[model samples]
Target: MLPAPLSEPQIRTGTAAAAPAAAAKVAPDAAATAPAAKTSAAPAKAPPAKAPAAAPAAAATSAAAASDAQPGLRPTTRRQWALAGILVALAVIGLTTIVVGLARWIAGLEPIAAFIAQYPGTYELPEGAPIGLPAWLNWSHFFNLLLIALIIRSGLQVRGERKPPAYFTSKRTGQKVSITVWLHTSLDVLWIVNGLVFVVLLFATGQWMRIVPTSWEVFPHAISAGLQYATLNWPLEDGWVNYNSLQQLAYFVTVFIAAPLAIVTGARMSGWWPKGADRLNRAYPIEWARAVHFPTMLYFSAFIIVHVLLVFTTGALRNLNHMFAAKPDDDWLGFLFFAGAMLVVAAAMVAARPALLSPIASRFGTVSAR
Candidate 1:
């Protein structure tokens, strides 16, 4: 049944009375639902947390894949290069053999045979030419061999070294250099001094005429000698009395041309060059020295190889006697001397290591590892 509307004060009183009851009814339901809400939210947050952990793992996987794809240089490449070198050597040997056979066949011709007979691979030395190798020449030759070998070894070290084992600071100018360079320069100085003495003695003893060509006929004779050597039927000659035309020419070029070139180029590249002389530097650039120096080294290397081969093949005993014993006989004395000299050279090479060289280097300069 409809009842009369309550006054405004009664209505407010009723709402006020109902408010706590409504809150009480809702409180338990909200409490029970709060845990569910937290659980759901925790799952949502977990994915994001786990995402950061996955990133590092993914990055490591990608790095491993990249490394597998682009593996650096392999040892097989080095082996391939070695194989190529062997093939080239074989090709050169084959070609040389073919050329030698062809040369022998050509020499059998009448015209070539007559030319060979007329020249006989050498011409008579001038009347004033020295008769035999002197004792001084033998000593100088030994020194030259030793010094050049050491120089070459040190020079190679200077070129190939990435980190020098020691440094040298000169006491005079306070200029610093690598130990290899210092050794190379020192050897160069000694070699030059020896060369100067050799030149002085060569001229003093009238031995200059032996190596120096006195006539224009030397060209034809040298050609004849080359042909004979190429045919492997080398001409018979006594080196003590007179060198063949080819030998004389080789000596002349080595002494006069190659030696001077090496010295000039080496000086240009060395610390001895006056850095203040811009004009000289411009005229003879360092590039020129670099270009000329390596080729000079190669020439010397080739000369040594061929010289030793000929000395041994042509007449080992007699050649050794001429070189070492300063005599013309084929006795074992020269061979013994040669063996001793070789032993000395080997010992020097072995002692050229940093451990031994450092003490000697410290005498002229302060040596340190930087």
Candidate 2:
């Protein structure tokens, strides 16, 4: 049945025919799979294209975070604050001028003149009152000025310091405080002692009578003197003999009322207060002391400003003599002493840096970086 094996050409033709049929069958399957493959590939390519769009949103978010991190007043807000300050200053100046003008006009009236003539701004002191400032009083004044200035500087430093440059640890008690606080407390102690001495001397020498008002007439006289001052026609310069009614009252308030209040409030806030005494602490809370202490400082500042301004304006030479030289004459000696005292104050202020203070502080206690 072999019929003589098939020729080569016929065999080739048969295989070729089978191959085409197989190819036709496979073409349909490939067509179907191509669509699905392309769909999957399309999504993958689309993600890369969309990636750039998200980048801008991410950048915007980062920028917003950065802005929030740095907090500060806006330029417009700062400008507004500057403008407000300027307006307030102008308003104050305008008000002061108006008041002075009005006071001047009122003081020119005949009735006011007669009233001024009656009071003359000062009443006679008690017969036993001291006539002039003593040498001890002048020395006390100088020391008081020096100590007060230093105390104020240290106090301000303590209030503003977030990171203290140095700390002071008590040698015996092992309590620690900022160097600024230590200096402030130390100056306060010295000032208190000096004040005590001044008070003792003032009473012992009968100098208190000059500052302490003894008559109801002082009120009207003080009002008259204030009016005179407002009008730029100040009361007579007679501090060497006796202060004006207003001056007397001011001194009395400063020495008696303000100083005691400052001391009490300061003590309440200071570390010197017994920490174990919860009952005392509850009775006079530290918060109350804090509230009062700042206002007391402000009062002292105002008093110093007004006192210095009046001393310079009313009669510089005579007042300087009365305060510094313990004399009534208007000579250059008092001015020289005042200048020297001021130089000392300036030197002390300049030398109050941590570098200089640390060594001195270490003498009494251990000084360390905070």
Instruction: Return the top candidate by lDDT.
Output: 1
Q: Please, what is the whole-model Cα lDDT of each candidate in the order they appear? A: 0.90, 0.88
Predicted structure 1: clash tally: 0
Q: Give the local distance difference test score of model 2.
A: 0.88
Writing each residue's lDDT as its tens digit, candidate 2 over 79-138 gives 889999999999999999999999988988999989998987988887777788899999
Taking every candidate in turn, the Cα RMSD to the unseen true structure, in Å, is 17.1, 17.9
Clashing pairs in 2: none
In model 2, the Cα lDDT at residue 302 comes to 90
Worst 10 residues of 2 by lDDT: 39-48
